[model samples]
Structure formats: structure tokens, C-alpha cells
Target: MEENRKYPRVRTGYQVRLTHRQYGYWVGSVANMSEGGIFVAELRPSEFTLGLEIDAAILGEGWDKGLPALRMKVIRIEEKGIALAFVEPDYPLWDSGKLSESTQSPNQ
Candidate 1:
């Protein structure tokens, strides 16, 4: 919420998947997300430093909505995970129906 307004963030609590060539595989939760990057919460701090390419999956409704499994470059690192920028998104993320649409409605 706060991150996206300032930096194109993705939905928090969304389960995300991370993978690397050498590290093999790992799973994490999205602490924060944005068009530019996402913060993951892994079991342990990631060895992935800046400039590493990784495949990320944004889990959606059942499994089909799962974000296009895009790649990202580690731009920042945290104690529990890493922040990454989108290598590529399935389509224009903002307009695509794959992700849920805002339901703020017209009353507010």
C-alpha cells in the first residue's frame, strides 16, 4: 500500500516463490511489492546479493492467477530476504486482468 504509492508496489501477504541457479530453490512471502521490486520473507537470509537474477512467482487466487513467474535482479538485500526489480511481467501489470482488480468502488 505505502510502497506502491511511492514505488509501484505489489500486494503484501501474497506468497511469492524465488529460485536461483546455484542456490537451487526457496520459497518466501511477499512482505512488500512494487512494479520495480518486491521484498521476500524466506526461512533464512538470502545469499543472493545485488545483481543476481532470480525467477519469482506471485501466487494468485488458486494457482492460475499466479503471476507470470517473472525474473528479477536483486537490487537490495534484507535480513530475511532480498528486494528485486521486475525482469519482465506477463503484460502491462497495471491493466492486466490476471491480477485482481481494485474494488474500492465509486462510493468511497
Candidate 2:
């Protein structure tokens, strides 16, 4: 089937720390990403509703510790994890030098 997504997802392995009122904080690996949102793997924590916003911080070797957390809303959920859309989509976050060469997929 043809993909109908406005943004094509690129597979990624970046880690993220998520914070929520009910769930507190937890770490999960980013399964993929696009300019619009990110798919965090192994993030299933209790029951999460659609449109529920959460605080997220990308954590990895090259990522800066000073970067502030992002406000992301749950858009979709699968058995493995949840897909979160940026509450305020900032295109620069995707193209920023901070993402850097180290975090890109092998094919990129």
C-alpha cells in the first residue's frame, strides 16, 4: 500500500526520558521520527489516552544536557509503544545541528 503520511518517518535509535503526572519518569528508545513527531518504543505505561501531553527529553551521547524538554502529545499507540506529536511543532528541532550526524540513520 502507498504511504499516505505527510511526513515520512526515519528509523532512529535515540533514547528519551518521558515525564508525566501519573507515570512520573521513564526512559525509552526512539523507534523513529519525522518533522512532525516521534515514535518511542517500550514506553507503554499503564493506560494512556489519545491527546495526552507529556514532557520529553532526548537523551544520548551527542545530545546536549542543557536542552529543555519538549511538550508532546500522544497521537497513536501500539502494543509496543506510543507515537507522540509535538505540541508546538518547531521545524528547526528536526533540522537543528543538535540532532547531528551521530544520530542519523545509516542510510542518511
Clash count for each candidate, listed in order shown: 7, 0
As a TM-score, model 1 comes out at: 0.63
Q: Candidate 2: misplaced stretches above 4 Å? A: 89-108
lDDT of 1 by residue, 29-88 (tens): 888876677888764764676898888877756556634678888887778777778776
- For all candidates in order, the CA lDDT equals 0.73, 0.86
Ten-residue segment with the worst summed lDDT in candidate 2?
89-98
lDDT of 2 at 24: 78
Task: List TM-score per model, in order.
Answer: 0.63, 0.74
